[model samples]
Target: MPGFDSEFTPITRQRLFAGERLRAIRRRAGLGQAAMAARLGISVSYLSQIENDDRPLTSAVLAALARHHPFDLAAIEADQPTRRFAAARAALDDPVFAGSALAADALARIVEQQPAFADRFIALHAAYRRAEERLQMVDEGLESGGGRLPWEEVRDWFHEAGNYVDLLDRGAESLALRLGDGDGALRDALAERGIVVATNDDPATLRRLDRADGRLAISAALPPESRRFMLAHQLAAIAFAEPIAAIAESAALRSAEARRLLAVGLANYAAGALLMPYERFRAAARAFRHDIDRLRLHFSVSFEQACHRLSTLQRPGARGVPMFFCRVDMAGNITKRHSATRLQFARFGGACPLWAVHEAVAIPDRIMTQLVETPDGVRYVSMAKGLVKASGSFARAPRRYAVALGCEAAHARDFVYADAIDVDGSGAATPIGISCRLCPRADCDQRAFPPADRAIAVDPDIRRIVPYRL
Candidate 1:
């Protein structure tokens, strides 16, 4: 695996008023002030001062806590004043709070003194936003006279579930471990079950399994990585049938078509999990600093598969960096989308044309990188790669699409593509919106349409890049 070289620099050294977090940690560990102070090699009065917000937790105290406590130091660090301040600031960018947003100092003070209240407010705002988006999606479906499309229902099911299926992920990882041995592990496992695997070259379907005949065939049209993925998909269909059915049943989807689609999606997820088990893949990703090419090479999976798997590493207490992943076709349609970060994809139509993913779609086999700031002022480091899958014949058209993976700029350290971006440098990041109809940027030259919620005024006498004034 390839790794990047970097200078070790601290993101911040500001005074952290983490009294509430400190107290919570101590209480959770059932330790008194004196006991915790002793463990941290600090005076009881100093510890008391720190807990009471009179003094900040010094680097030495943080180090001591890390060395002595069994808790997640990273979690503790993440809950500090800086992160809270960022979250509160971002949440306040919502248009609903337009004129009544708090100042930076006041927000920081509130986060320091009443962290729980701040958290609840952010959570409430988030839920309200989700509701609004869902309503918008429903409105679009109704306008189309589709009455809530089954595929959209299935998409929302995955989106609401955070794109990380715990039961399927765990089951797949267990199966991967049990298969044992080297490169031929999957094939060996199938052989043990008296099944023969072969290449079909039919191109009609990706895979076909005749259970009664103990035979399985994968399309030769697919590349090697996709072939292996299909193999894992077949394995999941057999070994995880019950769990997949249970998950689909519990989803309470509106249509039988939706339930069937959910099952297929779950099976695909299980196949990815089996091909690249969670723990091993996450460890490798961290080690390589999330280099997509290296990850694909190491796991013998496709580029899109590596990126998709990276987006799903959201296990509790062992989460990977929060990321957003989407696949866009040449027509600008978002075929697959998931976000573990603050960024969300457009629910109904095409994505922002300014997004690098759209550009990637025109130029296959090359990776594109960009530093983009959303309309809400959140910056992200985005990486996109265009790919074409062969149909194994000149007459059959190939499949062309681009997959994008990104995380907040704050997580630039863990993302390989972010090395090209100067996180602290002064530059105007390319401004983008979720979608044309949802975007608030009135000045965007590439905006195909005005925001759906806002009224547009047309002046026949005057003309600009956009036809109407928003």
Candidate 2:
């Protein structure tokens, strides 16, 4: 870079931006682009295009960057890994799975656990996005006529589950619920009442309880945790499922499918409660700091299963933190979320980058704590931890992930991870909200989409630094 500074061109910055950290390194070594591309087993044309900002860097190339230049791809990916999952969601768009809540949930899990596959799916989705965008520009009205987006429903399911299964586990622990022998226990318990657990692989049926054979089958491939949840639902369905449906009957849903998913999800929550008896689980939660992994082992539930149960700790006088939770893979798309709090989180839209939940993806596997205050002065202490997936089998192993949790800052003093929260306490912290779409912080660098209720008013008279002047 010393003597070559004058010879350098725009291509230099382009290559650097495309995950090629070694560009400057190679130049420092006095190697040419042709030489570097030759050593990389790639063509000079591709390298030239990458160098000149003509091409995007794929994960494959980013992986190579890590090997060759020792850069942190996870740090680089802090921008948006959820794009991978959003793409995979586009693949499982078959009407059959789209209509089934179980299939939709499975699709979400797959996308989150297998980002490489998700990336391919996203590329495929990008094509669709382009076509749809072009068609919209041509005729926006025609593009509006379709069934509700399946992804939106699945997103709600996750959010309702509170980002991870830990909240569910916490909720169950409040009651001392335990899923003994996992799915086997639910099946045995159901069999006692003349109900049998069955699998319906056919694309036509999902979660149908066959009374004639006294068997219940789900139409999708369920992970063990989900299977246990479904079985638990069967037991609850026999008793309170009808009652829960009665409740939903009076409520509003985006669609019949969404309503059904919500009803069954509640049934599953009830079943989890039965296994964990209320007072006993609450005692355990008080004993354990609400740490999910320990609760999972104690209750014999999966991490997600445990987290899901934790979100339900609200019952009149007995309540834990009225917490809001969410999970995101390396990408920004919210994979799951849940809230008893008043926060109305975005189900599929991007969250503000400044939010601690979004930052959790960067420090995978370790717990990250933050003291975040909303622009309105409400403060919360947030904690995030990384989780690796294991299916007990090879083919369906899920990818690793990190999740975050936070409670009102007033209650932050009671949590163990609070002391490490990244707060300077001098009020220099960036103001953030539940989602960028809802946040009103005009000076926020992380603002993406404007809040739904606000309109952007641009004045032609003054030159504004930001895109829109409100």
Candidate 3:
């Protein structure tokens, strides 16, 4: 039988030792060192040397164990060294070590010589992350009255579900087909159900549902796309009421309000899916090379809608590029966020000011693109656009926000915004952070505060871009 030993080089053997694993296996098998050595036809001293990492276990011994004992050779040879090294690198990249120059070789050596210590450090780092999230919840008033915020709970539910709801999507798509396709097909379907679709001039009334009278009134002030979205949303709530209720019931939310809000969220998701079927939208996205404007026009959806729908293209085998989508208000408050990629937003504060999203807010109606590199060395091709929704009256303030969408650099070739950008070229990408409090970049001139986890050294006499040194 083919064995893993053939894939191992001498350097790999030195880097990865299975001593601890072998000892655990032997102990679990209820065999003493002498007995185990005798079964493997090796001297007791040789077995002791292998268990202590003084000698590498031979392939013959591994095969013997596999043949006669309940041993998992693949488990013993799982590339733990690489995983531990990556974990150590991630931990050391924290703000606590901002100015410390720890090389990759040093981190690898720590994993090799002090694996137990490395494991402890990694676990501690995970605890720190949880603590940070808790602090953020406190700051956001989520910990008030000893209950989690409804919106936050809904957000977490979506995140855990991979930001995709197959049942909702398919149901909505089937309804869309039954309703027929055209500019007035949705309205016709609603009218057939004795649901009067009317528009209101009152700027304050974005949407109102009158179940007693069987009417749905939407604000005439909204854009065409938003108007259609509102209609589709109401349609989903009425047509798929049973399915939505079943899903919400299964959630077991802590509060009735949470359940209600989740129902609304699910209905909205279904609306988006109804307007843009998964397969059609995904194929169009690829054909347009993921140009937001093109997708918006082709799908007859708003720019924000197109961006949000792109983040949900997480179908199992036929998946599109994984992307992160977010919307930030003029005050830098994150109103909506979801990521199918590894790019996670800050749970507490505003996004990094250096990011192009903020700049997009200043230049409304224009799309801004940037190549950004995070502290972990992963690069992304990000695009953002600012939008304003008119209130249709002088007394009411228009809603303003910027929506950002992006994917990892590895998928840049399929992204239109990345066509003229050199994502891999040196000095081509802007260095950005998750947030100031959690960012570990010591030289960032736009840092609003020193990292909360790191110590700050102040020098009144030698002030640079920032007042303190990390």
Candidate 4:
């Protein structure tokens, strides 16, 4: 409870001029100048001036508009100009640009004078970084259609989409509103379809559906939260089948197996959305400073489910704190990964050994927090916890994994885990990276291997933790 309510604190800015964003809101609402002006209780000329950037937006008009419309006022107040300026600066700071980085003033000038070019420059840098990452990653298989696996193809599809399916999310939210009841919603939904829902004592499968007998059985071995999630997943797979199929079919996947995998992924996304309705869940998460236990209890969801849902809160306007979420098995294999921030997870091999998630995997049920700086100089506050799911019988082994969730240091105030660390102290962070092969920190003593593309020279007489020098 110490860091709760941090996100509700108001932010102060020196100036606000987001005319383009205001104009976009008006266009999205399909309202003409006169109508928009009337709704905001302002004159048409005044509205036109504001939209054209001839005048700054006042708080009173913004308040009036928020009262009349369903817009995310916080997002509007965040100022696109400031965001673009920061993005331009960050892209320039990438090591690829190194000593040729532009000054803050020069970057600001470009953002102000040629916004389109600035945007393009940032996008090009992102593409370059992605290409660099792919090159750094170990080849899973050949790039040809025959060698690419369905799971990998589906993973890439979700990654490219930023793990957010807008249409499916909104549709699931609508269904949630209709259901009203919490866990009972899933049962009622299945019951309406003439299917009897019950729990099965079998430990072999999570859930089994028998259309022949019009019955659905969920594994009784699961915890209460997971049971509910499994129910939602089964229900979503049934209700959202058409849209899920459409999305899968729309993908440029080469094989039928890839399409099938994509459809399952979409259905899983929809199930999470249905169980934790976006607007309500995001609001609660902000209130709790993204406390996983608080979120899981409030939403009646599993911890992993809550963490996974947090990563998908990228709904443009009503976005939550941007964060990366991943799950690591006991072997340090990252089974799940997504980033709404600059921190990308390694696509192959284990994650960086210095990451706290690896430590959490050894110590189950305890939350571990760490302040880490990636090679790019961006700091993050991470919270990781190891979990064990019961197998309900001694004959079977339980599933064990650790989940990590974190955001960049800029949003540290809104992330509760950062409270115990010094966010402003540059030297307080432990240096970390995506993986050993992808990391650029040659001085790190815990490095497992050298960069795949960088040649190293070995000193025959030299003695150090690592035998070779970069």
Write candidate 2's Cα lDDT for 1-470 as tens digits: 00111112212222224435445444532457887676455688877777665665533343343333221233333334423433344344323243544233344345445656767765765576446334422332233343336445544454434433343434444333444445666777788889877777753444788799897887555555656667766777665655567755654566777777767666666667756555565556545656666776776666666555566666533445556677777777667676654344554455668876666666656667677777556566777776765444455555566666666653443355565664447774556776665566777655665665578877778765667754
- 2 or 4: which has the higher lDDT? 4
Candidate 1 per-residue lDDT, tens place, 1-470, comes to 11111211112344456787788766644468888888777899988888898876654465455443322344556445544445556677665676795544455556666888988988998899888767667655654565657898898898889899999999999998898534378787778777789889798688888889998988888888888888788778778989999999989699889999999999999999998999899878877878999999998998999999999988865667778999999899899999987678877777888888999998999999999988767788999999998878888898899999998876665688988788666684788988777788889999787887799999999999899988
Candidate 3, 339: how far from true, in Å?
Answer: 0.8
Q: How many backbone clashes does candidate 3 have?
A: 0
Number of the top-ranking candidate, with TM-score as the measure: 4
Instruction: Report the C-alpha lDDT of model 4 over 1-470, residue by residue, as the tens digit.
Output: 00101121112334466678888766644468998897777899988988887766654454454433322354565556545655666566555575695544455556656888989998999899888656644332321323456776788788879889999999999999999857787888978878788889898788888989988899988888888888788788889889898998999999999999888888889999998999998888877878889999888888999999999998977877778999999999988999988788876658999999999988899999999999987788999999998898999998899999999876665677888999888589899988777788889899998865588998899989999998
Model 4 quality (TM-score): 0.80
Alpha-carbon runs more than 4 Å astray in model 4: 1-74, 77-112, 133-147
Q: Per-residue lDDT tens digits of candidate 3, residues 361-467?
A: 87899988999988877788999999998989999888899999999876665688887888779999999988887789999999998876799999878979899
Q: lDDT: which is higher, 1 or 2?
A: 1
The model with the greater lDDT, 3 or 4, is 4
- Write down the TM-score of every candidate: 0.78, 0.54, 0.71, 0.80
Residue 404 of candidate 4: its Cα lDDT?
98
After superposing all C-alphas onto the true structure, candidate 3 shows an RMSD in angstroms of 13.5
Model 2: weakest 10-residue lDDT segment is 1-10
The collision pairs in model 3 are none
After superposition, candidate 3 runs with Cα above 4 Å error:
1-148
The clash count for each model shown is 0, 45, 0, 0
Give the C-alpha lDDT of model 3.
Answer: 0.78
Whole-model lDDT values for every prediction = 0.78, 0.56, 0.78, 0.79
Please state every model's RMSD to the true fold in angstroms.
9.5, 23.9, 13.5, 9.8
